[model samples]
Target: MNSARESLEAGYARARQDAARSLETKAGAVGAIATEGAGRDIGSTLLTMDSRLASLRRHSHDYADDLFRWHTVLQWLGWLALALIALKSFLYVLALELFHSDERMTLGFDDAQPIEGSYRTGAQLAIDRHFPHPLITRKQLSNADNHLVLAPWPGSSPLVRIIRRRYFFFARGSLLEDGGRVATVADTARGMVASAGGGQSIVEWTLREGEQVIFRYKDFFGASDNVSLRSELSLRLSTLLFGRVIFHSARCDSGEGRLLLKASVEAVDQAQLRAIPLERMIAWSRHAQFTVHSGRTPWKTLVNGFTLVRRDRGDGQHGLILVSSEDTGANTGSLRYLKRIFSSIF
Candidate 1:
C-alpha cells in the first residue's frame, strides 16, 4: 500500500511540471507577438509623417511658381499701357494736322506766311521777348549775312557776355571777330575754332527756315548703347509740332559733318520721318563744344547728347534750350536756358 501511494504522488508532480512548461512557452509567444505589433504601428506612423512632409514641399514649390507668373503678368501689363499712351499721342497729332490743313484751305491761307520769319527772325524775336535787357547789335563781324547781338545778363561778370550770331549762311564761312578771343563751332569740317582763352560758343547747326525736324544727342559712359534709355530723356511733344527723332555718336576724333549727316539720313529713312507734319526746327541753340574729360582720355569719352527745352509762356514769346554738351556756367549760356525752361515747365 505504501509503494502505490508514493507512485501516485510522483506522477502527479511530473504532470504539474509539464503543465507549467507549456503555460510558460505560450506566455513568451504572446509577448513576442505584442512587441511585433508595436513595432509595425511605429513604422506606419513614420510613413504617414514622411508623406505629409512631401506634400508640404510640393505646395511650397507651387506657390513660388504662381508668384513668379503673377510678376511676369504685371510687367507685361505695364509695357502694354505705355504702348497705348504712345499710340494716343500719335493719333492726336494726326487729327490736329488734318484740322489745320482744312482750316488753311477754307481760309485761303498762304503757306509761306506762317513761316515768313526765317529761323534768324524767330530767334531774334524770341530773344527780344524773353530777355529783359536790350541787346546791343554788334557790328564786329565782316560777313554781310552774319548778324551779331551782344547782351549782358543780370548779375553776370563783365568777362562773360551773352553773344548771339547767325552763321554759315551759304556753307563756306570764316569768323575773324577778335580771332583768338571768340569760340566758334562751325560745321563738322570746321569743328570749333577757339584759343587757350575760352570764350562763348557760336553753334552752326544745319538748320533750315521751317524744317520741323529736331536733332538731339546724349552721351553715356557705358558699353551698352541704350537707345531706349536715352529716348526717355528727350523733350515731350506738347503739341503736333515735334516728332521724328535720331541719335548718333562717333568717336571723339570722328570727322565732322559726313558721319553725322549719314547717320541722320539713315535714321530718317528707317523711321519714315518725312510722313510727319512738322513746322520748324527752332535753331536758337548753342554752338560751342567743350571737352569735359582730361587730355589723356580725350580720344574716347562718353558724352550726354543734347536736351531740347521749349518754354511757351502763353504769350507769343518762346524760349528754347538746345544743350549740345553739358555745361552749367551762367555766362556760358546754360543757366539762362535752364532758368527759362524750368521757370515755365516745372
Candidate 2:
C-alpha cells in the first residue's frame, strides 16, 4: 500500500510543474505582443514626420522660385526706365538743333495812322505819345520812397531814360533828336552802374514831331561779347515794332545778352491785336506780295532780307506788312531797316 501511495504523489508533483511552465510561456507571449504594438506606433509617427518634412521642402522650393522670378522682373523694369530716359534726352537735343538752324524774324505793326508825320507840334506831341500816364498823384511823388523817384529824369521833355550805373544801381538819361539822329544827351552823375543782368546804358530820343524813342544798351562781361550785341539789337528792334501789341513776344538770347520785350496792344479791348488763327495768318502772308533780297558784306559775309506787303481791300481788316533780315555778323543795313520799320509803326 505504501509503494502505491508514493507513485501517485510523484505524478501529481510533475503535473504541477508542467502547469507552472505553461503559465510562464503564456506571459512571455503577452509581453511580446505589447512590444510589437509599441514598435508599430513608433513607425507610424516617424512616417508621418517624414511626409510633413517632404511637404515643407516642396513649399520652400516654390517660395525660392517665386522670389527669383520677382528679382528678374525688377531687373527688366530698371533697364526699361533707363532706355526711356535716354530716348527723351535724344529728342530734346534734336529739337534744339532744329530751332537754331532756322533764321526768321518777326515784326509788329499798328493799323492806325503813321506816327512819322502828323498835324501835331514837337514837345506837346511827344508828351502825348511816348510817356505813359503817371502811376501816382503829385502828392505821392513827393513822399519818402527813395526807391521810387518822382520823375524818372529831371527834364521838361517827354522822353526819359533809366540807366544802371553800378553792379546793381539805377540812374537816368535824357536826349533830343534832330531829323533821324540823336542830337543832345544828359546823364545823372553816378559811378559805373550795374544791374541784375549786367551793365546798361539807355538813351531817350524825341522825334521832331513824332513818337519818342527809348534805346537800351546792355554790355556783358564774358566770352560772348559779340553774341550779346547782336541779341541786344534784335531785342531793341522787336520792342520798337511789336512791343505795343503782343503781351509776351518772342525773345532772342545769345549766351550773353538777354532782352525781354512785353507789350499789350489790348488797350481798347484788344481792338488792335486780335487773336487770329496762326494758320490763316500764315496763309495770307504766303499769298501776299513777297520780296526777298540776299547780299554779302565784308563783315557779315552772308545776308538775307525778306519784305511782305498787303494792301487794304474793301474788307474791314487792316492791311498787313512784314520785313525781316538775317545777317551773319556786322552788316548794319538790316539793323537800320529794323529801326526804320519800328519807327514807322510806333
| Candidate lDDT values, in order | 0.29, 0.30
Give the C-alpha lDDT of model 1: 0.29
The best candidate in terms of lDDT: 2
**How many clashes in candidate 1?**
9
TM-score of 2: 0.25
| Ten residues in sequence with the least summed lDDT for candidate 1 | 258-267
C-alpha lDDT of residue 120 in model 2: 15
The TM-score obtained by model 1 is 0.25
lDDT of 1 by residue, 194-274 (tens): 111122232222222332212332111111011111111223232212232221211111111100110111112211211
Clashing pairs in 2: 164-193, 165-192, 165-193, 166-192, 166-193, 166-194, 167-194
The lDDT, on a scale of 0 to 1, for candidate 2 is 0.30
Question: What's the TM-score of every candidate structure?
Answer: 0.25, 0.25
> Cα deviation in Å at residue 118, candidate 2?
38
Candidate 1, which segments miss by more than 4 Å at Cα? Answer: 1-232, 238-346
